[model samples]
Target: MNAGFDVAVVGSGIVGLGAALAAHRRGLRVVVIERGSEASGASVRNFGHLCFTPQAGLARDFALTSRELWLGLALDAGVWLRESGTLVAARRDDEFAVLRDLAATRGVEVELLTAAEAEARMPLAPGTAVGGAFLPRDLQANPRQAVAALAAHLEREGVEFRRRTTVGAVRPGRVETSRGPIDVGRVIVAVNHDIDLLYPEVAERHGIVRCSLDMMRVAAELRMPLAAPLLTGWSLVRYGAFSATPAAAALRERLHSERPDLAALDLNQMYTRLPDGTLIVGDTHSRGATVAPFQAEFAFESMLDETRVLFGVDALRVVERWQGVYASGPDDFLIEEVEPGVHLASATTGIGMTTGLGLAEHVVAAFSDDVTTTADEPGFASAPTTTLQKGAS
Candidate 1:
């Protein structure tokens, strides 16, 4: 079956969908091939926190571009999106220092809050925060709703979706699938961690691994509704903008020394309240070539305990528990040209929700002659192909 298309996206995940959207916008015949009937991957399993303010370097550039696309989706695709900026509660002096330092560098983008102000804005325990910061540029979406809505919107926009079809291989101008091979002008591989399965050499060359996360949703009574997606000191050490601060080193030391157990779990204590008011609490990271299906109960318990302490709640009714995985690599992204006319794209860290769309847009624009490059657009001047090399220090 030669259903010729100008572009073929190899996954229905956020990045893949973004590629399809970009190609479709350029008047290219686009087809999305998915192994499952729907998107059921890290795209849905995340906190839906679009923390764009904390990104640095190339990730920050992509985040800025993605922000515009996301806002457009809200108006065009009817995707549920909130302009609610990210809130960071700093319980300790070191945590406050990290926020303070970032504020100094970022100026209006990072607004520091007093203890009282922090408590009033965020649903933290009355006096749990010594200080905090609000990142006005961030956003929140319902992970369960966003991707599905985006997929639906793309389908309505004349993009062809071939769901329940497994992609066996991708060559220069063809995508071999479970159903049959399709002729494509270009191929965009955005399968996240599954890149290892489809293109083992590319995955290995980029030092890609699976980073599994433990997360849960619970119904809980709060001091007040969370003003936005909330981050804790545990988060300060993870994000590029916060972690790169001079004060972050001391903060990291204090956190690890105080709670080795949480450190061992690789915690990024954060919360996002869904529209239904259930709280999404997570998460802990563990990375390897392969992740264990058995999630440790202790990791969940630790998260629950931290949540109870942070919110000053005694009880929480557990709604769901699950594991989410993404592609983890040494760099912030994996953009490569495995072969001519076939591009590989993946957010190597947990920033896919923040940067995936822009990454896909840039990748597609690199090959599309119709797409014009703009001076203001970040990462659009040149294709990011072959940037991540194997064993490059």
Candidate 2:
């Protein structure tokens, strides 16, 4: 107990922090080792939107569950969450129908609106198109703030985080970091592409890779209208670029037929209003193994063009340009005991906000050798409350 840690987790990203929290809650002596000063990876990058809808199957469930946990954290840790609801504007009739179907699904409640109806609610400047579905449960937060707060909370729980420290080797019941060698009952690798950096054998056990793409944040508006996030038909079409299912394929075809301009633009994007009126828009492309470090300016521009065509916006001030790196390893959640004392987990399909907590719980249960005490609440665990107050992280 005085010598090393019960579990050593590599990577200080969202997943790593979630894992540390889960392990700590289960009463395991946990330590987190990060290669960055803060969460200097994809965890803190991109729009800090904890997406609520347009999610299906497992990711949707995990997202809902993570949101529940976030509510508790907001109450306890004072993490900020803007409770503005999401609106899916249906420029065309078919799109409106699709949203209707989405709402019809059990456990999903969506509010429909007409052009006049939506304008009154959203205050869209009269010509902001028409027809949309409003779901009030969607929420957004500052990713950096949330991560920092989580790190602090874990520290208070005696969970140690060694920022800028690298793991040299992973052996069963121990981890060798640049800081020093520490023995442990279990080791968890939460790093995405660089996971192999600590344990080369992890490459054979699990595919570790990066996802490169463009992200844009302008300095126009300083405040967001509502606390929720936004996505458009561009997303449904682009979802096909990543998935090959029949529904996805049909959706792609529909997008091509109804909105050929979107297909031509190569734009699969989701947009959210920043707190100040500037917008946060993104993203496309999912590289399975190794994502490149290039920004497709044309793709970004196309996203803007699609933005104009969809929302009919003339222009907004452009300030920030960004790139996001993500990890994915099929539908399977990653967790591998590489050797006697080494464990590996990464490539989580860009669902960090959704599945991180569930994954955390799973990791904790496994690490404790099946000793567990986590039960799901009736509805969602986290609900939209007041604006989250800014705290330490």
Candidate 3:
């Protein structure tokens, strides 16, 4: 029972794994305890689109830090990553206005593309795009592979993983798991939406709840391969940076008035093509204390209809479909030390893959004196003792 670990992380998702990696790099003995046999949560059930360029405030800070960590993982851990910047296809002038406003603010980070240029870059139906913008700094990864590879790489670096072990309680210096008691210097809870189960008070205080989304993979014949992760006007109104633009209000109002059905679904219509050429399409949002297990078929049909209209393709063979759930809150993240020696870290939105690593690193660095932050790693500074407040990434 006495594992002699310096840090014990709960959950094996990206944030948990990132915590273990950060602690291990600081020469601390780390143990990860997961209730599942493997990581089968939101970590793997996402688009793997590192759309950090559209983030604002603290989320943007974490995103910049995550970019470096992701690039390092690609070289060190062999996690497959691409520098494929995000491509936003604007179907309406209002959407283009939002992108243009963002481009004005971000300069080189946001590159405005003409209608012809946008069509040339992506396999969109010719002339479908009035204009668009390319986020040159954003990246992409295979969600199915990145977390597993990172976990495996951590295991090779002397971190121990206790899979199928349920953690019942955590206190100042001890964690009570189903296996037994573990003595550790620190405890990090990164269980995403399940934090409610472990620490109801913390979840309640932050207004944390589950946000479920439906996503699918399909094999489709395109005019050409998807050059990068694609975002539609729906996406422009969802991400923080774009939504904060003055032009976003008109865009949102117009879209909602035009397509009440899609707006009813709370869609963030986006797509990312996997390395094998299968396109990952998603998704629709529904938030509650607990989401329904049943997914509506109409959601899938709507996605298919949108996909066909966007790409001008007739048929798409369905490969798979599933639901992805993540922590949702009023603010962008939930980083707190609810009790002495016990910390909570979670991305309270869909950008966990984009910002989770940096969030984890920031939390660990806050309390651990051994964590070294180089000059190049900006925004890795220790978090304030107060709660972090910002909009969604």
Candidate 4:
């Protein structure tokens, strides 16, 4: 095996791949090491929503930068990217109020439309939507395909990848892997929910926890061209920019009163259509480093029940069900130097797809200095309290 490189990335998720790209761009010999044969974690399990409209502060900046990177890669790497913005359906007066408040406060390009208008623009059940907001900047892609394309692109560009290789230990100038030890100049471990395996002390001290969510995919009744991803009243309160609005408290109260069951599971309904005429819907959030092996049937039931009410559809043909877990910490992401040349970068929240690219750039930059010790690097200190909010938003 080629054990020599200027930089070694210890995971193949979006953040890891992004770091490898950043290092290669700086003329560094970079190699990505992955325990799995392919990218099979949160990066592939997400909704693939490269959404920035709902982000605020530093997260918004990162999302914008990542969006540019995604677009360029989609074109250059032949990855499928759908220019689908988000259409949030407001089924009640309170939800509409929250959307209006968000539109006014967040200076993004948003359009307010009547129930009829929203239904006409997107395929929703009749009279189900009272009104909605159309955010035009959001985009979508197939998470599974995007990650594969990205890794493939890196390989073609001279970056090396050692799959099915686990890192046993990380130190200043060498990585002890399951296969063997490799000499490396710098090491960045971007492992997502499994950071404890490599740096338990760092993960625990940073207050990092795992956030698990339920997701489902179903067959569409017909081949309908979905102009954008569809969201519901729950989503109005799920996203940060919308939930932070003064009107959000009232909306949440209404939801709790009207549909306590959905509130219990943290259920939020949003659907995106695949090219094969299937709809991907889901998700409920539960926080813990270790989740139960079993999935609750009620979670899926709540999602489907809400989908029926919002879309006014009689039934949704359930196809497949699964779960995704990501690391969640005190901030948008946790970046700290655990050793002199080893840095740990993990997006503790769910916006890995939205901000992973830009975060990787910052991670690589931290190693750009001439100093040998991490203490010499200015940005190697503890991570900042991210201004971006975490949750469904």
Candidate 5:
């Protein structure tokens, strides 16, 4: 079978869907090809915390754009979105210095809260915290539902989807899939960690590899009115916006001295309360060409222990545990023309939910402009024709 469209997206994750949506809005007929029946990759296996404040430099701008895009998509699709901000509490003096520095930034919307103020807003242990800052710009959503809803919304808007189909090769204006070929004006590959499957040379040249994370979800015995995601000193040392500051080194030293185990596991302790009252907590970072298939018990224990220490609670019950992998490179993202008429865009970091949509927009705009300029150039076709055949899951 052969399918014809103006734009063919090789992956149906958030990044691919974002590209399809942007192209469709520009009056381009788009079709998304997914290897699975649904989006079951890093898109759905994340915390779904749109932490814009923690993204520094150009990454921050993308986060802001993605925030707006997410809101509109959720509203249009009737998906549940929790406008829960993020509260990063400083547990140590060094961490306090970082928070204070961030609060002093003119354009940043972070409020430095005292220990008492922090406790008043959330159920934190009194007299045990040095300082904290609240970022009202952060947002949250149900990861399991948001991606699916976006795909469904795109489908409803007349974007075709070829689910359960693998893309085997990508050439100029054409995509050879396991089922057949898809002809298009342009092709966007948003396969993330699986980019090597279609462009192994590009992936190897960029030194791209998979970064794995261990995350856990637990049911809290008490339903506290937690308004936003919670972060501790560990997060300040992990998130780029805070960690890139001058005070981050001191905080890292303090953690390595006081909690060497956490440093070893690369743990960043944070928690977000879902609508169903379960807390989505995580995670430890581990990277390699391939990840091992196991979760260390101590990693889970360390997370729970940190949560207990931070909130003065010990009633958390583990409900689920899982691992997620994402494409990682030297930079926060990778967008390049791996082949003629084919553009590759990937959120090389784990913050795809935060910046995927914005990157997609950029890829679409750039590809569109390039295609128009080169419409008369060699090796470019402006027409297409095909018939579709449904594939088995």
Candidate 6:
């Protein structure tokens, strides 16, 4: 292979892939270097749900643009994107009101439904559900399949992917990898959490921090199955994006102050159905540098316990389990050209899957001579080691 290229992208996660593809589309020669044999980290983790729900207004615009970008890329790449709408089951009346507000919100096409209406669509939904909000345009995909398809598509476009290569040092116009140094005219560091490692003081400048959580996949319950990626009242509290909403603020205060399990446990629930008829049950967050040992028995019982209470599906069998981590910040996202030819970006929030393409596309635009200036942009706040949100779990 050639010893150099026009641009070098670090990390093969979705964000890195998004940036690489964007740059390649712009006619720049690009090479992607990843540490693992294949793309890992948060790329192929979680529900693979293309989150359509807006994060205030920021995610609204990004997600809308990202949807268009994702659809276009999948069409060109022949990747399968499931049109699985998201159902957010609201347990409280206030939760239902949030759905009403979201229905009127721009970017996201939400529909508020009564319990009967929601159950009619998926009769198997928990009878305990009082009502729900459905995002009709949201979708899902197999993360591994999509990323692999994307890599192959990039290969077809003559884009180079250097797998099993680890980057140790990043400099302007050059990147030093485990394999060796590669010369380039521009560099984009999309290594996700390792963003802090590459830019050791990144935490100080970019405010990069990590959130660790558990995710599990469950087998189908015989003939019955879930209709889509479903989130109950529990999930609203788990994901800060929802919890941070106006109504969610009151709920957050209650859970933080009154509820013992919620305040101490920080448990949030998300259940997404897979093509194989299995349900992808997840996820609870605890923010810290290190995570506790995988409590296989606890995780198993805990998730299933939640599933039983939240979902009506019975006889659901456990199939697979895994853990995931990602970068998130206090504000919407950390998007800035920290240095010339060195673009630092991270989706510490769950928006990586929800809004990655557009965000990466934005990075590509910054690579231009106009946006790639040396001066830092104003009003763009840096992520601090100590944030007002108490760091995500």
- Choose the strongest candidate by lDDT: 3
Predicted candidate 6 versus true structure: per-residue lDDT over 1-393, tens digit per residue:
547788888888787888887777667889988888888788888688887663444554556656766776667776668787888877667667566655765555677889888666553445765788787788887787888888888889899988888888988878888888899988888887777777767665655577776788887553345677787666666453465556766665655665565444456677777767777777766666444556446655777776775555566677777777777556556665667778876676766887677667677765554323122322111111121223231
1 or 3, greater by TM-score: 3
Q: Per-residue lDDT tens digits of candidate 4, residues 1-393?
A: 865899999999999998887787667999899999998999999888877888766666667767777777877677789878888878788989988897788367788999788778877767777888899888898898999998998999899999999889899999998889989999999998899888888888888888889999986563236677887777777666777888999989988888888888787678888777778898898888797768989898888877666566776799889998889776777877778888887777788998888777767766775212244322222222244344334
For residues 1-393, write the lDDT of model 1, one tens digit per residue. Answer: 557999999998899998998888778999999999998998999999999899877787777878888887887788899999999999999999999888888443888999999988988878798999999999998877899999998899799999999999899999999899999999999999999999898889889999999999999999899879999999999988889889999999989998999999999999999999999999999999999999989999999999999999998999999999999998888888889889999998998998888888888877888676555533233323333332111
Q: Would you estimate the TM-scores of all the predictions? A: 0.94, 0.82, 0.96, 0.91, 0.91, 0.87
Pairing residues by index, what is the TM-score of model 1? 0.94
Clashes of 4: 4
The list of candidate 1 runs beyond 4 A from truth reads 106-108, 373-393
RMSD of 1: 3.2
Looking at model 3, the pairs that clash are none
Per-model CA lDDT versus the true structure? 0.88, 0.63, 0.90, 0.80, 0.80, 0.69
Residue pairs of candidate 6 with colliding backbone atoms: 207-383, 327-348, 328-348, 328-349
Provide backbone clash counts, one per model: 0, 26, 0, 4, 0, 4
Candidate 2 global TM-score = 0.82
Runs of candidate 5 with Cα error greater than 4 angstroms are 369-393
Candidate 3, 1-393: lDDT as tens digits: 466689999999999998888888778899999999999999999999999899887888888878888998998788999999999999989999999999888443898999999989989998799999999999999988999999999999889999999999999899999999999999999999999999998899889999999999999999999989999999999988999898999999999999999999999999999999999999999999998999999999999999999999998999999999999999988888988989998999989999898899889988888666666543234332334666744
- Candidate 5 weakest lDDT stretch, 10 residues: 384-393
Clashing residue pairs in candidate 5, if any? none
Query: Positional deviation of 205 in candidate 6, in angstroms?
Result: 3.8
Judged by whole-model lDDT over C-alpha atoms, candidate 2 comes out at 0.63
Highest TM-score against the true fold, candidate: 3
Candidate 4, poorest ten consecutive residues by summed lDDT: 376-385
Q: Mark the 10 consecutive residues where model 3 has the least summed lDDT.
A: 377-386
lDDT of 2 by residue, 1-393 (tens): 226777888888777887787677667788888877888777777677665565555455555667776776776666776776676666555556566666666677678888777655553445664576777776777776888887887788688878887777777766777777877777778886676566556554555566666778754322225335665655544321223223444555777887565465445567766656667777765564556676756777777766555554566556677777776545435555667556565535665664566555555555465343446522123212222121110
